[model samples]
Target: MPTLTALSPEILAKYQPVIGLEVHVQLLTESKAFCGCVNKYGGEPNTHTCPTCLGLPGALPVLNRKAVEFAVLAAKAIHCEIRETSIFARKNYFYPDNPKGYQISQFDKPIAEGGWLEVPTAEGGTKRIGVTRLHMEEDAGKSVHDGFMDSVNRTYIDLNRCGTPLVEIVSEPDLRTADEVFEYLTKLKEILLYTGVSDCNMEEGSLRCDANVSVMLKGAKEYGTKAEVKNVNSFRYIRSAVEYEIERQIGVIEDGGRVVQESRLWNQGEGRTYSMRSKEQAHDYRYFPEPDLPPLVVGAEWQAEILKDLPELPEARRARMEAEYGITPQDAMTFTATRAFADQFEAAAKKAKSPRRVAALLTSEITMRVRAAGIEMEASPVSMDGLVLAADLAESGELSSKMLKQLLDTAFANGEDFLAVYEREKPQQISDTGAIEAMIDEVIAANPKQVEQYKGGKKTVAAFFVGQVMKASKGQANPAVLNQLVAAKLDQA
Candidate 1:
């Protein structure tokens, strides 16, 4: 490709980029897809393999029923239409990690299809990203090429991951920008996590993405030549890779060069993509139905069983939380970051006297402290009831703002439960009317210049009186009532 300069926004706007993502999620099954080998990660190399997974002679593959259920649950979570019947096909490829010579995957018929996820757009609205298909397949093992003592270029094959079940979700070519793509992935992952179908841990290779990117003139009817970006694990890296590929393709076309259709690997260290090989078409795989496996059937009874206990999806759950808790849409979104977290919050809110105030405390203070300590909401040091108690104190004017901060900090530092700390030794907020009035009177007698400033129509000087009263009261006076009394007294002065 020829070198090209960066175009201005006006010039860049003349071209459009089309993007799509194919995500692979490893199911949380107890064993391999075709055999009884343990499906867990991080075992001795080749220890989790079996005759079926190793492609040995006289071995027959059997479908894992748990894998099917996971696939069905995931499909339903994405609002997909389940197929009545689907067949597995062989995807032929040569690699050290693939001992079976071909991967057993879905071809003409997949488990489900015709789903859509609504992703948030930059305009504060949402755009629908069409889900093409969700299909189940077997995973290949890993080839470890590093950690060789003698530098003779030897690679070690670990069959521990072979035959692990995976479901690949392919999306339509509907994405126009990297931001939209990021939003779509985030929502998709959120749905997947909500369903508990997969762990979606990119660090462990349980979740991965392949991005298809193309660029064309803004008004062009046909798309530009597309490239497949393979093996990007992180969402941020996926966004960055798609963006770089789009601009590179546009640059190539503008500089009188042809963009080739190929497979590229994202180099995270260098922040660029390099060609790996030519992108293969379906015919190149020469796919055919698996000989050992029969066409899988999904009947109405099975569908009903799966749907009967299906959990409410993210959007629906978020709406319900908003309606029931009387929280804003944004607060609902924060609370619904995870299903368990939302459930915990709702349970706590139900017991609180001031539910809205409890929600506020959770979203603002509790969530922040939990995240700052590198822990999840479920793992926080504070109990839900304890948090509610603290919120109740604040809402009822029994705990001042400074007291709440000190409570949270002390609770966090000591790894003490908030309620235990509150019940043991809480702040003595001075809510007594006469007591506060006496303190205010003493402050007024001490600060004559501030009182004069207040009487001279500089009404903002009432803040000075409140501060003096707060100081005189040793930070125990209710700030809200003090402000009110100070304002009323200054009006009289």
Candidate 2:
């Protein structure tokens, strides 16, 4: 086992961290990858399994057509070049959950390879992370250890997840910091969700990650002994595990010790990684072709059909929004992060005559209201027309920015018509310049000393007079108009 320690300043200054990630995403298929069993989570133990999933003798496997189509669509969406023909190979292993004594997965010839995902960095820059390969595999069942004098003393297994279709996206060691990793994961999840490939519900174990972390000299070309952190299900854990592992490895090397190559598990509750087992090599899996299933040949026409069905990905949408709407890159990125959010934003923008105002409101006022209400953008009661109406009201001076925020909150909560709400609220406005003039005259007569101060070149006292006039008019006096009126009145006083 490797000893865990903190990195010294010397090591931190001299070395740069290298990181790669292997993400396992369970496909949203109706059935198992190779069997007709239900591919659902959280059910009675073993209730969703069939003879094939249970690996009974003489039982054969059949590939689910929808699963393959989804895999190809995912591959194309990520900019990967799909192999015209891909084969399935058996990876032999001994585990209670893997009843077949071997797992069907892609080895030498995977379904997709050589792709890239662009992630946004904290400094408002973008980094292109290279995808090494994307392959298909079946998930193993979960091992539950519970119900004992001590929970650690007893162990149980649930085979419901066995044979579930999964796509493993392998990335190169291009990430240098934890922030980069976070951005990459977020962007990847957005793409996956937009494509309808996976639900990406981390709480239900639908998506998981294994991080490969190591430390090398800052400008060196070679790598270091890397530790594979396994079973990290949440983004917070992924970040913490990588940071901790980087410090641990650097400390060991600085103290005249060598880091070992091994696999570890992240204890999210404790916020650390513990040794799980030694890292296995390719030979350890005993890779061979599965006799039950034949090779999969994706013809050109099939690939073309999947490509035609692919919608505009996040990058394309972001670029289009930036170009067409003249919004900032960051705002465009935010708007296009989700399909539904992007669609709603576009719909609202179309209804709004002022694109700049629409963009600003969506990113600021609307976003703040949505966050305060604890609801998603798509679920907000404020419709596209409602937003357009709010923008128009603000543009027409019917509402100030402050009043617009209040109006948006009311609209979101009650889903009432904005015009009707405005009429009912009827916020006082300084529409009558004559009324404002009378109020100004009253203030001038009441505050003769302030008027004298203004005439003596004490310009700051003019604001006080304006406030008095506004107070007399119940905050309905237009401050701008009152300012001009007060200046003119004081000039002759």
Candidate 3:
């Protein structure tokens, strides 16, 4: 390829990037998918392995019922069509992490297929992203390349993760931008969390994503050669990798060169994707049905039983919250980041005079303080009841904004609840018109120059008087009353 340069706006706008994400979410089952060993993330290397997971001769594999239930629950939550009968196929491969020469996974007939998620767009609208399939499979072991004195020349394999149950969610080539990719992943993760199937923790290898990127001419029917970018640890890095890969493929075609299909690694440090191997060199897997296990049957009765109590999904909850609370779309999103948090917010909103006020205090005040304290929202000194109290007080004009801030600060600093701090301080708003007018009079007499400026059509000077009076009253004056009193006093003067 010729030396790459930044493309002009016209050239950049001539092509559209198509991105698909493959997300692997480990199930939170108590045992391995096909074994009796404990299913967990960290353990002594190789200690969690057994004959079945290790693929020992004549060691039969038995499926875990809990894994199937979890997988079905997740699939239903995403609106996938659950198959009545799915077969387990042996995906043959040879790698150090693969204790078995082949992986037992669903091939032609996966557990579920044909789902869609409504992804929020930058234009304040939503677009449906198609889910190609959600299939159940076992996970491979970890390959540790560091943390040893001789790690520079050695590799370590930990089989604890081997045979752990997983569901790989593959998205259709529908994402057009990096932001859409992010929104799709976020929505998917949120749905999964709401279903309580998986934790979706990217840091602990419980969740992982691989992005396939390709670009095509604006009106082209066929997509350009696609490259799979792997080893991206977080959603932010995945977005960056997809962007870099799209540009690279575009650059190749613009340089009179054909884009090559290959697997690449995302180098976060360098902010680029580098080739790992060509698609031609990739393994065939030689998939075939597993002879040991019979066809897994999830009949309609069982499917209904599994999904009968399905929790309301994230999107549905967000929409309902927005309508019920009369809160903004942005606040709805924040409140529904987690199912538990959403429940807590709703409970408080129901008791408070204004649900919008509760939402405001949460996103604007409590969220910032909780994050700054490096604590979880559940651990915040402000409980849901406390939040309700604060919201009610603010709505009733019993607490001024400044007074509220002071009380919140003291609560956070003293490690006490908001109600405790409020009761101790007993801060009251001065809504008495006469008292506020008296303070305004003093401020007006003290600053004749500003008073003259106010009367001389410099109407903006009224703000100075309001500030002076507010300061003199120590922020106790009700803001609404003070503003009205100041304007009236200014007009009279």
lDDT of 2 by residue, 108-212 (tens): 999899999988778888889999999999998888877667545666888999989999999999999888888889888988998887999998898999999
CA displacement after TM-score superposition, residue 385 of candidate 1 (Å)? 1.8
Q: Could you list the CA RMSD of all candidates, in the order they appear?
A: 2.5, 3.4, 3.4
Q: In candidate 3, how many Å is residue 67 off?
A: 1.5
Write the residue-wise lDDT of candidate 3 on 12-38 in tens digits: 788999999899999989999999999
Q: Estimate TM-scores for all models.
A: 0.92, 0.86, 0.87
List the global CA lDDT of all models. 0.88, 0.84, 0.90
Candidate with best TM-score: 1
Q: What overall lDDT, based on C-alpha atoms, would model 3 receive against the true structure?
A: 0.90
- Better-scoring candidate (lDDT), 1 or 3: 3
lDDT per residue (tens digit) for residues 335-412 in model 1: 888878888888988999877989888888888898899997778888888889998899889998888888898898
